[model samples]
Target: MSEVTTPAMRARPKRYLYIAVLIGLLSFLAYGATYPSMQAEAAPGTQASLEVDVDLTEWELNPSQFDFQQGDTVLFNITNSGRFSHNLEVSNTAQHLNSPTIGAGETTTLEVTLDNSGTYTIICAIPGHSDLGMTGELTVSGDNPAPAEGEFLGIPAMRLSPRNNTAVVGSSQEVRVTLHDFTLNADSIEGANVGGEGHWALFLDDELIASLGEPSYTLEGLSAGPHVIRAELRNNDGSAVEPALSSEATIQVPAAAP
Candidate 1:
């Protein structure tokens, strides 16, 4: 003889099954709340491979300004169109990239990987070439945060003392300059092109007389006549500041006592 199974006994097993399922679900929810998901993080900025054409001529580089994102690989197709041998050099404090010298009517390629973001000096490596204006600028932007207030981002303003139409009573004169939104980084002179930090180039009668890392300089051996003095902001690599921030003053130096 077999014993009959009660309805309550059967319902007890169903309740136990439901309770086990509920407990498992609650445990899963708790674990999810405590730990973060194991998903892959996104990359910062997107990198790009680019090709650019550059024309080299006497004391000039066509397309003098360049813009690019950081971590870019740029292949420069350089052609010498002038009647001289020229080579290209791109440099900053962090890296230096150069190309072989190519003669007129010749062509070459330079591959550069811009890892850092800032300003880089682009110039012809030949002697006296950059002085004659065979220079350009390469600007690399990154995903870095923006600069705070009091940080320079554009061209600076300059003013020279001894305002125009002033007279001095000697063969030497002291000129003082005032600058705004700029810093003179004497340590990095001729090193690399950094943003917002550089020295000043002093020009007397349209000729470069000195590169000043300070604000005041004295002029000696001056002729007894009117002279024009100009102060121009320059980059660390000796390149002219963009938009050309400069101040000019004309003064008369009287003859010395005889």
Candidate 2:
């Protein structure tokens, strides 16, 4: 037997369907509100952008040399691992860029576009820093580029003991150096470049005799007569300090008895 059509029964089924649709719509809206849209990632074996890691330390930059392709965008991740403050500067004839000073144990980022092919100088803008070997080079493949000019720093105050015209009875003489705004690091000598820290170069009669790590040095094998002793501050790599800080002392030695 065929069932008779009833509008109320059919209408009830439609109402249930409507309620299900409404619940589904509400659930969709709630999920959308709770979560953010996902972003597309780069395909495998591909990168969205080129990145380079740079390390800054006592008077040096890790990966001191690197290269990039022309017209490519690069992101430099710079980290300061040294105790002193440092900054990075990238300059070429086509572009010049600088990063803010990064204190010890800090990190920063620099983004740049290499539209032109050439060599870029990377250095620490802090005075006397680059001179101490806090520098690097970036080569953008293509054409030759002009070399960047170097920066200079002022000299520190220095004083030498063993006053001029002082008489010495023995062949050995004691020399002392008093430096201001600088430190003597004998352990770091010939190790790595470090700012505001290095050893002193001792000169006798304008000749290099010794590299002194301590403040005082005893000179031996001195002949009887007027002799000149000089001391100059130098970097850990034995490079001459900027502005050439030095002090001299003249002393007289008596002749040996016959």
- Per-candidate TM equals 0.41, 0.40
- Candidate 2 has a TM-score of 0.40
Per-residue lDDT tens digits for candidate 2, residues 59-100, read 898989988876668888999999987777786644556666
- CA-lDDT, candidates in order: 0.81, 0.79
The residue ranges of model 2 lying beyond 4 angstroms of the native Cα positions read 1-155
Q: Model 2: which ten-residue window has the lowest total lDDT?
A: 146-155
For candidate 1, give the lDDT. Answer: 0.81
Off by over 4 Å in 1: 1-153
How displaced is residue 102 in candidate 2, in Å? 53
